[model samples]
Target: MSDTAPTAARTEAQTMLIAFDGSPEARRALTYAAEFLRPRRVEILTAWEPVHRQAARAVSMSGLRQADWSPSGEGEDPAYTEARETCREGVNLAESLGLQPRAHMVECATSIWSAIVDAAKELRVDLIVSGTRATSGFRGFWQTSTSENVIQNCGVPVFVVPPAEEEPDADC
Candidate 1:
């Protein structure tokens, strides 16, 4: 027999939650997770915020009531449907890559990052995967990027895939 050594053991992620928003960046994150992590349990989460709309009734000068609004949809909030659809796409993509993934849609009136962090905690995922379109300069400082927020707030390990850079237009 040859004197060859065995390769080191590979570390596996037991459970991973992928933040999917049906965006290109999100898809890239999912793709990275599928190719690299390939966790036994994959959770695809899509968070949606409801749109605020004022009630149709006329407002009285004496008092003002809370605005009545829901997501745009037929009978149900459309945001829910969109979130579900986004999750479905993520699940299908992951499944196609031979991973068994579950889809989850969370509705939140606040920040989407908060929802993602909450889900990760509740699911007890070993890792959280997300895509980042890193912003720079003044806007980046003023705005709290979702991926950065998740990374900062999440307790579990977070894997972030930065969006691929596009080549500058020659005409410019």
Candidate 2:
């Protein structure tokens, strides 16, 4: 008989906050949480940084009249719209797992990491779950990983799920 040992399962978290951006890695993290921890309550928080030119200009420049800045025929900002859709998807995923989920789309004026940490604090979740992708080269060195930032800045516990590594074909 093989002497393989079974791994003990971790205790389920009471409340969990998932940082989702509708990416494939984020989806995997969600799946992992649903199958593993299965927290009592789940909340999906998407931090959206507005990239709209007019909005940024208004916020950046001083003494700029808000009434003078009119949208250049653009009805709604796409970035925010996508954020809302992502939150909805997270909610649907949670429902599929037999859990009621609350979705939050927070508009971040500065950085995404700050927004995530703030949400976790405001919500007072027991844990935070997010996914991270491996990066290389100079760009990777300069850019800070969101997961890493959350782990550092957030007071609550954080679970960062790395992307699944691709396996080479046996034929090779």
Q: Candidate 2 — which pairs collide?
A: none
The residue-by-residue lDDT of candidate 2 on 27-128, one tens digit each, is 889889888876656888888876564465556676655554444556667877888898999888878887778899898867789999999889888799
**Which pairs of residues have clashing backbones in candidate 1?**
none
Residue-by-residue lDDT tens digits, candidate 1, 85-139: 8889999988888888888888765688999999888988878999988888998
Q: Which stretches of candidate 1 lie above 4 Å from their native place?
A: 1-13, 53-74
What are the lDDT scores of the predictions, listed in order?
A: 0.80, 0.81
Query: lDDT of model 2 at residue 126?
Result: 74
What are the runs in model 2 whose C-alpha is more than 4 Å off?
Answer: 1-13, 53-74, 169-172
TM-score for candidate 1, residues paired by index: 0.79
